[model samples]
Target: MALTTALNAASVYGAMSRLANRAQSVQTQAGGSGESGGLDFGNMLRDQVKSVVAQGNASEAKQAGLMAGKADLVDVVTAVSETEVALDTMVSVRDRVISAYEEIMRMPI
Candidate 1:
């Protein structure tokens, strides 16, 4: 049981990293020219939020299809698992960012 749980966690983290790498690649390509560009934090955060929402919607759709006898149980499970991983990654990042902000606020400068 422990081994199974470990593998499951590893798989989720691997999926999360792949998604993060893909997003990073797109951002790099967009900012490559460096002539008409700079990173827009607002847009970046908005895009990430949109992606998470879309993943959630897709997972819900998969669940609905399964209930309607139009989808495979495995597929629905995979969709839901992927959405869960994405959400976990986002929460971890948020926590780290908040911690950093708090640390800066406490600095003597």
Candidate 2:
């Protein structure tokens, strides 16, 4: 189990590194300096997850406020809808990433 975990971590790191390199190359080609500029994929994903969680929390808070007669129904509905969309987008990205990983694993090394 430890070996599998290590391998998974290494694979994710390698993929992120490759993506960062590609982004850096594109930026360089577009007349931008090749500085790191915080193009870390893991950090980006972490930030996005945090944003999604915040959105969900806000949506719940809005619903609670509506229940307490302190918020409008339209505001609650909008918050809930936005949260749903963000969650759905995150799930879709996860599925695609998993699918890509599986496909890569199936490839001959």
Candidate 3:
């Protein structure tokens, strides 16, 4: 009976430890940083923009190949179109941000 009680205690302790570790993992993910404990929005946005640009460049290359008849016409058109749209969206966002910055600067403090 003593041995069974000790075993149960050990099991309960083990389970608690596991739960604590899992809670820490979830907190880290939700907070987005292990040390600072918050999301880095600027870093995330930069990373996303970099990926989009890279994808657009790849699509442009594919489209160029299609133009040379080395690739299918439909594929080329689709890739080029998608790249154009992505680039346009990026440019518009940049313009809007710049405008907002300018407007903020013009405001009297």
Candidate 4:
């Protein structure tokens, strides 16, 4: 189980690295200035959400493969673990964002 978790974490790290690389390439192509050319939080959030959805689909695919005897138990387990972790992380981020927004709304003028 610990090994599975570690492997899943590594996969998440790889995904993050890929996203960062894409963001950098996009920034360069757009010729964004240092101030206005920084990564957009909305785009990053959308990309991460898409990544999480893709992971979920992958987990489902692995399960189907296991059922068809085309995938190993370990592979299915790892995919599911990765999906679960990604979903949990996304949910946590969403909750924190909401909390922060609420706090800001409650602040004085």
Pick by lDDT: which candidate is best?
4
Candidate ranking under lDDT, highest first, comes to 4, 1, 2, 3
**Model 1 lDDT on a 0 to 1 scale:** 0.72
Candidate 4: segments with Cα more than 4 A from true spot: 1-35
The 10 consecutive residues of candidate 3 with the worst lDDT sum are: 8-17
Which clashing pairs does model 4 show?
none
> What is the number of backbone collisions in each predicted candidate, taken in the order shown?
0, 0, 0, 0
Candidate RMSDs in Å, in order, are: 10.7, 11.8, 22.5, 9.0
Candidate 2: lDDT of 39? 76
Residue pairs clashing in model 3 are none
Per-residue lDDT over 1-109 for candidate 1, one digit per residue giving the tens place of the 0 to 100 score: 8457545644654565566567667768776524347776645754775677678767777877988999999998898789888878888977998999999999997
Q: Candidate 2 — what's its lDDT?
A: 0.70
- Give the distance in Å from residue 108's predicted Cα in candidate 3 to where it truly belongs: 1.8
Instruction: List the global CA lDDT of all models.
Output: 0.72, 0.70, 0.61, 0.76
Q: Model 2, range 46-75, lDDT digits (tens) per residue?
A: 567666767776777787798899999999
